[model samples]
Target: MSANTPMLITFVIYIAAMVLIGLFAYLRTRNFSDYILGGRSLGSFVTALSAGASDMSGWLLMGLPGAIYLSGLSESWIAIGLIAGAWLNWLFVAGRLRVQTEHNGNALTLPDYFTTRFEDNSRILRVFSALVILVFFTIYCASGIVAGARLFESTFGMSYETALWAGAAATIAYTFVGGFLAVSWTDTVQATLMIFALILTPIVVMLATGGVDTTFLAIEANDPTNFDMLKGASFVGVISLLAWGLGYFGQPHILARFMAADSVKSIPAARRISMTWMILCLGGAVAVGFFGIAYFSANPDVAGAVSENPERVFIELAKLLFNPWIAGVLLSAILAAVMSTLSCQLLVCSSALTEDFYKAFLRKGASQRELVWVGRGMVLLISVIAIIVARDPESKVLGLVSYAWAGFGAAFGPVVIFSLVWKGMTRNGALAGMLVGAVTVVLWKQYVGLGLYEIIPGFIFASLAILIFSKIGSGPTAGMLERFDAAEKEYQDAHL
Candidate 1:
């Protein structure tokens, strides 16, 4: 219809493929478990890719790049922190959580896991954790929506309002149809596209500017601090940036990949694959940002829009450097990164609604088929809410993401780590840790106004709360401690 016809067509075909994958998954989904966790049947590669895709989100393509574009190498500490956190998560939390969740009441969701893990008969853990997830994930999902909106608006010449809703349509359709299986399979494909795009774009941009040496000349001439990793960096800033890795221990969507793995033996392989992919993808993302400084500096006319909105660096570069078809595919990779995570978040929210709230509180005997439809319905509902939340054209993807990441990291990170290792963790302690972690994050962000990131304080306070409350409140019963030991033994035995 216009000059953007090819890109639009590429996007259409990609979106259609995602929907078809969902339909295929729909056929295989036999019960609620299959819909929520894909019957715990994912292999190592799929598990790794899905986890990476979901965890990285549009932050990988847009937010991270934008940060580097604006702030230079100093912004890269976030990536380093994320990589370290991801490695630790895979190493310490993955296999143990997989074995423990399966043994501890076969929990289907994070809230369910918290409830069963602590043996809380009162259901406070389920309700509170579910509420926390719904609150933060709604914001998290909105960030993904904002990323998609930016992609569509930049790539197709659409208004932000139209792009916002349009971007969510395909993600909701596929997630509503296929459930977890569809999300995972589509995530695998999207992950490959994202990696290819990130790798190819940076290589092209680097060559276009002559080479690394020439690119550095351009960047340094334009702004010297772009090369200085420690320029204007403070001790507090460095610690705050590095603390992002702590978020990994409590990310429900990433942890879901571990829960859905076909077996504990699959974890080590999955972890290796995931870390390798993460390193490559994160490096590529940072390269795009760093090289963008050189590319834009050399071409001021083309950099007009990007200078104003740094987040558009990736999209603008693809358009300027590549032919229409190639750019379409590259832009599709941005869409891939956005959709992959949004769909996973929506599905996880759906599971929380269906399994955690709907069934837990209402319609206790709902059939598997009915539950499946309800999950689908919630997926649509949550997507609409996220769309509404993303209506602010001024919303920064990274800003929203940082808040939600801190919320989850502070609320659940310390509690998750302690619960997994410390058999003495009581229900009151878990509750105290979650409440203190979440509340402190809020207060620190809103009131403290300390230049430091909230997660640093929130995480520390939460860990202290758990330790203190565990001592003051009733400790875990002997039976619960025995079960914890048994699960720990089973995990170690399998690894051996």
Candidate 2:
């Protein structure tokens, strides 16, 4: 038997528990609302944790750590930008999105909300938005799958393909069965586990390497760039990279939480809880990476042992620092980070397909029972496709996530923000913004050799599209303008 057998067993048990929780959630699902939004009954804590867990995902473990290891303190700016963006999203977008969605009789997905908001009864906007959701979400889901594959490969010595499928299947089973409730509940648990892992691992690694002072001194002596926030080799690149926080405005998975939130009043609490969790968790992850550098430096042999795969920084630390039992649990925490995210993305994408497209256009007469089946079917399909894409093993989690994030941010971010804040935002303007934003991201990623990240160009084009299209295209209809004004007034009064 492999020496890591105990850790492997723990991971298996963790996967089983997640699937069972999903099954439990599935059993309670009696209707579409229950499956999609948990009947809008989620409290602030559940909503907050779920949102933060899903948002952070593998990026927190792999991307953030890798950044700190390779770059340094500059990586923290990404966390700073994200924290500020999240706080503002909760403060501004959450309450109004929730109230307006319910008022508009849209209970399902982001595209559905857009359709109802602009009174796009013609279904053109719905179809276009659904297409964007599916395309970008497929790529987004692929990134999470890559992270899961990496976790399995690093910990269990499993083949990437085998781990990829196992991770995908486990998340799909739960998400398909339990829907939103299962996703949120499991996310909350996973978030707690992740926090524990982040906090505990760093402290232990630091102690094992003598102490923080000794460790920091070693890092400084070994590589001065490791301590310099700006002069760090990839500092500016990382900051430009982390500033991708602006993409939060349009992310369907994140914003959907706002829509399904119980009330605007609950939003502030959720915001506080989520931001605190992110700051601590993300900060800990960065610390883990930087500390891993010092720990490995103290024992150069351990660094050579896992030389080929720097992404396995956390896994290597687990084996070096903990007993089999604790390592087992820590392994599960990594899985939690990966799976928590995959489950949420799968649900959001499935909801977009079933509610926004299938029900809206393809099968208008489909019953709730049939729609539930359709959602399950879509979840299965997306999981398979993501697994196929993940087979390449070369697509870095951070890169894939960045592309998908920028695409969604460009396509939907400006449109959503303007729709909520600008009464003059027209259907034509929204459509132009969506198309321009999405296309700009794709083109910039593909053809632009400018060397800057695609997100910078994407955001610029997206913002421009919204501004120009809103000005040049037909203005908002009179009735739509009136509704916007009323919604704005209500938002102001409620906050005031």
Candidate 3:
């Protein structure tokens, strides 16, 4: 047996345990509700941690770290923006979404909520929302697959294609079996593991470099600009880039957690827990990246010293600081971040396809069993497509995630936020807002090439589309407004 066989065995066992948990979750799941939301019984910790873990994903491990390594402390503004945006989402959006979704009799997906809330029993809203989810989520899920593949290729010396398939298969197996409950439970565990790993790595790296002062001096001496937050990037560029936080208002997976929370009362606690977790973990990830650059720069001749691919910062540090046994566990945390998100996104996309599109229109009579199978089939198909897209090793994880994130945020974020707050938000206005927001993001990413500054354009276009369309377009029907009023009243009374 190979000397490293124990490490491989441990990794395999960890993955097997995840799949088994999903299988067990499936066995215990009695109905679609159980599969999707665990009967909406998640506590504050589970909901907050799952939501944060799923939200951060590969971006936390690879993208954030790489950003710090490349751009220095200026990247911290992104963390600041995200934390602020997430706080607002929890404060304003979470309680309302959770209560209103249940009050409206929507149980399954975001499109389901849209149809129920707006009284658009017609198929147009459902189909449109489903299409948007599918389009953006495919690219979003592909970015995650790319992160997973890169982790495996860099750390385990696996082929990129092989790594892609392995990662996809693991994520798909669990999500397909366990559904939302499994995803949430696994995410809770994964999120905790991620926090531990994130914290431990940077402290170890700092000790390896003497201390913070020594590390900073080394980095500053190596490249003075690395110490400057906004030295290279312009003021406008910084604001525009950090505004990526605004996109969170519209993200389906994150908002889905808001909708699925057990109650409005859970939101405040969830918000506090989630915000604290995001700040610490994201800060730790950035430190890992910056410290990685310092560590490697100081010791260029260490065995397996990685230089060019700054993304390897985390993996290389894991290997250098720990034995293969502990490194394997640490490596799984990276995979955990990637898989937790991929699983959630895949299920979300599949639900949109199966529930929103297939059942809503194509086959109204589709049985739950048949729909379940369809969702599983869609998961497989999407995984295959993501694997195909993840072949390009040079594809930047941050850039891809940023584009997808901005697309969802700009297209859906404003509409979701305003729809909840404004009684007069019309269906046509919402539609227009979503279309313009999505189209604007795509055009900006493809044609504008504004680098980190693209998110601002998308956000402005989306917000304007919502405001203008609601003002000029046909307002909601009297019946729709009446229903909205009733739902709002019921929500208030229930909370009160």
Q: Give the runs in model 2 whose Cα sits over 4 Å from its true position.
A: 232-239, 395-401
Q: lDDT ranking from best to worst?
A: 1, 2, 3
Evaluate residue 78 in candidate 3 and report its C-alpha lDDT on the 0 to 100 scale.
82
Each prediction's Cα RMSD? 1.6, 2.2, 2.4
Q: Candidate 1, which ten residues in sequence have the lowest lDDT sum? A: 393-402
Top model number, TM-score: 1
Clashing pairs in 2: none
Candidates 1 and 3, the one with greater lDDT: 1
Question: Over the stretch 1-496, how does candidate 2's per-residue lDDT look in tens digits?
Answer: 6668988888888889888899899888888888888888789999999998888787787767776776667666778778777877787778888776775555477778777677776878788888888877787788888888878776777898788887787888899889988998899999999999999999999999889799899888778887776664364476565657777888888887787777677888898999889888988888898998888878988786445666677878888899887899987887898888888888888988889878876898988889888988999988888887778867564355557877888888888887877777777778888888888888888887365667667777777887887788466777776666676666677677
- Give candidate 3 regions above 4 Å deviation: 1-3, 303-305, 392-401, 449-452, 490-496
Candidate 1 positional error at 232, Å: 1.2
Q: Which ten contiguous residues of candidate 2 have the minimum total lDDT?
A: 232-241
Model 3, residue 229: what's the lDDT?
79
Clash count of each predicted structure: 0, 0, 1
Q: Summarize candidate 1's per-residue lDDT along 74-141 as a digit string, tens digits.
A: 99998999999999999999998898898888998989998988889999999999989888888888
What residue pairs are clashing in model 1? none
